[model samples]
Target: MSHLVSNAATDKISPTLPLTTDQKRLVDQILAFTTAHVNETGPAVFTVYGDAGTGKSVILAHLFNQLQTASRTRPDSPLAKTTNYFLVNHPEILKVYREIAGKEPHLLKKDFQRPTSLINQLAKGITTADVLVIDEAHLLLSQPDHYNNFYGENQLSSLLAAAKVIILVFDETQVLRMKSFWTEKRLEHLLAHYPHQHVRLTHQFRMQASDELVAWINDFTHSQVRPLPQSVGAQYDLRIFNDAEQMRRAIVTKNNQVGLSRVVSTSGYPSTLDGGKHYITEGHFHLPWDQYNYTSTPWAELPQTIDEVGSIYTCQGFDLNYVGLILGPPLTLSPQNQLEVHLDRYTDVEAFKRRADITDAQELTAIKKQLILNSVNVLMKRGVKGLYIYAHDAHLRQYLGAKAH
Candidate 1:
């Protein structure tokens, strides 16, 4: 919950800078769409989709702040008195809201039997609000049956009913877990209910111009966006180290040169292999936010910067000058002898039982090829400058070799 600015340069970039051309275009479109709906006095929804690290969250944050500011300036404006809820993955936003409001926002306690009712009450308090911006919209649109049976009768229905204008920010390409709520079909369905406006964020300024990670992601997503070919001198700087020791040595050496860089594994925890170390986790490795209690061996406290043990999940909303990715398991070979992997497609029953190891025969059998394709698409598309892939599995190596060579 602590906010630390790693570098001074980041601080210079305020949260509400003048919108870039892309941002301006999206905002103008959104405003026009919302105005039309508001004129009709009907509810309207706007869905924004982009690949991870494409600055969807940043855009949303900017939009939210802009709308709130506009509302304050014109109390009688149709968009005045807007209600905004920035739902955090672990209710972290609750604290943030409390800080922003300068008062204690309602905190859902363990005994709160009907959380939805609480949300409804909160919505009622801001009934006059003109807009409600929801960041992490993917979480709400998840399947009703996934995870602790928390989703019921469409999670966004209550919020939708209360708000005149709703803005949802999310990326369809980053669903790492099978919580039923995070499916493409579900997203499509949710937006189908309303005459929603859809915007796709395409430009990625996070990484250097030479980086093709975004292009690779777009290709993986079956998007029209193409990676810069090697002919364009746009090669990803990814390399596979021989082993963990070699990787460690390289990191140590690189740290001296760059002051400090991050070493991330696709796995959440460290794993031991014959020739390398693996870290596997239920979530993606890179994330913009830091994980609580994550630490490295011989270091009592976890590194403050996410650049230390960067995972895709934690590093999704973040960017770096260089990214080193350590690929993890659930690897296999396709009929065409291509690399096939389905990281989140484990067997339903075993995953329900919370099995630590993904070794159940049923789980492996249920693995979906599409999920494997999606995983590879997400994993390979994370670098800005270079990609260093160390494939311990020979089958995977062969498949990658076919593609890279």
Candidate 2:
């Protein structure tokens, strides 16, 4: 198979194409809604929700580029008349946009200390933009405090007051990140309060039909109360090699069959076991500069250092054809022999404590269970054909048992 080259170099990072059949229908609906609203005298807000890695960002990028192009050529066109604004939480998105736009736009630095200033700054930008697209809207509404801080005195009101069209892209399922305020109820409240045209992106194009990981995630999120079959399950094909040598050999073999342009997800750091070096496949890895620090280098320069043992928060909006998750020390079983799960991603301590099994809840133990479940969900969903598990802990193996198959 031939690899398609992207117009922009950044597209090589994780390039994806347009939506599939079902997704196209949904996109058409969204476009129709936007067109209708653009024609109206009043402002309008459009919301799009979907599962993680379901092409929300891709769609947003496509829309941005298309609108920008249309505006450039047909200055009188409805889309052309609209000034586009893309709001995102990740700095990476800004970097990608900068690369795409080939220039820097006016930057409004956020002031975290003086919360009111942040809202004011965000509100101030709306007047210049005819259309505003806020990606990862889930994060904006996940926290009450941040919600108040960002939207205090009706910040959305201010934005709507200025912009002719406001589009929000959110995924309730991907609300695992820290400082996120995503929830089904919160989204509903937003729609009700704001009176926006809401649409859901449900057709998953990232994972293939053979991926069982999707079913696991659905079950896990909806509570393990539902019956899920492996036939229609969303899972990945995972393989465990004895060491890095075997992993390297496997990756080389796969890439040879496919192409050199393939990518693999791995932890961003190196691990030394005894005297041997264990390197993760592809992508750069980085050792933490400081144990308490939360920064790392990009995966390209040090592909071996990319930490695959990331939380659900870090893994959002990313998809892997094949995920090789390394189980670190933090995810090992304790002396008590219980599955201690961590809920630190959750802001509500009481809710976390209540859900966690306190009987054997050591830091490592809790981390282990959470990692296992999360890794199982993440790693399994990553592959279209299979899933691989390399559990250093024997107890975890026993727990996974037949399910690992």
Candidate 3:
């Protein structure tokens, strides 16, 4: 396959790959559960919970592939003649799955769809769902969003009503918007009403970074700051650059040597819904945010995408050889070298839209900060081989550079 057809990011989650031991066990359990409850009156749910880079996507991909194969090709199998669909909220990831469908015999492009599309289809009575496998279920809209044309109160709730079996992956930390806000407690309560089983995959499968380095990134996302782990420099190419220009240069070099490397950032720069470019500028470093991808190919896979800066929307659920992260203006270091979120500086207004459920000022503000940190968490885990950093705040950049020994 050509580089555009497959690369590190797409290959990591390819459906054709063999599953790991844990993944295989989970798949077996889900399949057994479906066999036992597919004909039951209530929906049978097999939820998979894992943080980013824990191989949730690939496992689901493999599981769905098996389901489709059994349903379409196996004559004597109990799952034969069953209908199944693979759903994901992320458009970029949906593109990858659709592309992969073209190369596989049992997988069909029509089998992959966005959650909103499926929900609307079921509501319109155009098609009925049987088994639905949803990836990144945390991104599902819990509120009625007419902007995306979803009029349902909760997406998963509708899927449960429509499908006999539902399988999904969830990561509370990956929740980005108010419309899709979810907590562990919320998920547990929802699952309580259905016949459900869950498994949590804690293994680190994406980043080549050391355990200490991974823990450090996790702590940072939780708004905790600590001295950099000594294993960073030697164990991974975790570098903190004083200049965004230099970091961009490093990322470009890595991209030339190994494709899938790009510069990404948090949401603190100038951005709007206008169709024009919104450039992110920092001392001699300037690049526009990733444009709306209209083509079937993913943005990160496009050859010219190296010139653009990726945001959480485009780069989530992706893998890179190296990622040069420009810490946007919303993030800064305090007097004690701790990270702080400057909500006033955040430009992504869509992420902080008013929610009828939230009224307390302090609670709303805290959630906004968590959303900012969650974006950072998504970017930090993208790189498979290395992670490069540059902060817009001078003091924050200096502190990161000094601690990145």
- Clashes (backbone N, CA, C under 3 Å), per candidate, total 31, 45, 0
**TM-scores of all candidate predictions against the true structure:** 0.67, 0.63, 0.96
Query: How high is the lDDT of residue 30 in model 1?
Result: 77
How well does candidate 2 match the true structure in TM-score terms? Answer: 0.63
lDDT, model 2, position 224: 52
Identify the superior model by lDDT, candidate 1 or candidate 2: 1
lDDT of 1 by residue, 28-116 (tens): 68766765666455468888887655666556655655565555566776555544444433233222332333321222121111234
**Tens-digit lDDT track of model 3 for 1-405:** 112223545577888777777788888888888777766665888889998999899888888888999999998877788878999988998898998888889999999999889888888899877789999999988888898898888898888889999999999889898889888788889889788888898878778778899999999999998877878635368888887888898899888887889999999888886899999999799899987888898888998989999999998999887899988888989888878899999888888767898899999988888988988999999988899988888888777654422
Better of 1 and 3 by TM-score: 3
Cα lDDT of all candidates, in order?
0.48, 0.46, 0.86
lDDT accuracy of residue 117 in candidate 2: 42
Candidate 3's C-alpha runs over 4 A off are 1-8, 233-235, 402-405
Model 3 gets an lDDT of 0.86
Q: Which stretches of candidate 1 lie over 4 Å from their true place?
A: 1-14, 35-41, 88-130, 144-151, 183-185, 209-213, 217-236, 249-260, 267-312, 333-336, 342-376, 398-405
> For residues 373-404, what per-residue lDDT tens digits would candidate 2 score against the true structure?
54335434543333444444556444444242
